[model samples]
Target: LSDRLSRRVGMIVPGLAGMAVMAAVLGAAGWLPDGAALVTLVAAWVLLAIPDGLHRSSASALVVEQSPAPSERGRFMGALGACGALASVLAPVTYGFTAQAAGIGCTFLLSAVSLVLALGCVSRVREASSPATPE
Candidate 1:
């Protein structure tokens, strides 16, 4: 089947949006009645898996597809790994502090904000990578 949607526009957008939505829902769940919160949490988690899986499935393919040259792919992958490492170390501590000061709900809101920032960064990368049209 001819794909109508490019990975840049199609997969990433929905995936990021799903993540943001999940975060927001989770945040709001904190204010819900306990039973309702549990149900919301379950539903949010279940819904998030779809786009998250889609995003993850495309992630390695995206890396390879976007790499300008074979030599640069390693560099790109290394940079990706470095980012994951940094986030792994920083997110828990930063989130813990935010939660301690604000509330658990705030931490999820912060996660949503982080996802929005990630989307912005991805947009910038797409702009940088796209081939320019001649005037």
Candidate 2:
């Protein structure tokens, strides 16, 4: 479902999901009442998961689409997998220190900022590679 959605909308799904994550993260930053905090946390978690799932599926499909040849596709996918593995390993340690030093709220804010930056980079890459359309 998400794969088809991604194909139709390109980066918009992930981009919007990233924005939702930012909003939810900000909401989870304790502006709400105690009762609402739990709800906000849950909502934020769900929003974060949406982007994660969408990104993984879309990125995998993009890898397959962009690979030059069948022979190189395996290597491309393997490299992508390696990058994901490295991120999984490093993210926890990085987040722990960041949260410890900057507080959890700041950590969430930083994560949102990173998401925005990533979205911008993806947009630029897509624009550069996309074919020009006739007026």
Q: Using TM-score, give the best candidate's number.
A: 1
Q: 7-120, model 1: which lDDT tens digit per residue?
A: 556677678778988999999999999999999999998988987776664554566556777667778777777888999999999999999999999999999998888777
Over all chains combined, what TM-score does candidate 1 have?
0.83
- Model 1 scores worst on lDDT over the 10 consecutive residues at 126-135
TM-score of 2: 0.74
lDDT of each: 0.75, 0.64
Please, what is the TM-score per model? 0.83, 0.74
lDDT of 2 at 91: 77
Candidate 1 residue spans exceeding 4 A from truth: 1-4, 127-135
For model 2, state the Cα shift of residue 19 in Å: 5.9
- Residue-level lDDT of model 2, residues 15-108, one tens digit each, is 5457657554664656668778777777777666666766666666666656776678789999989988998999789878987887676667
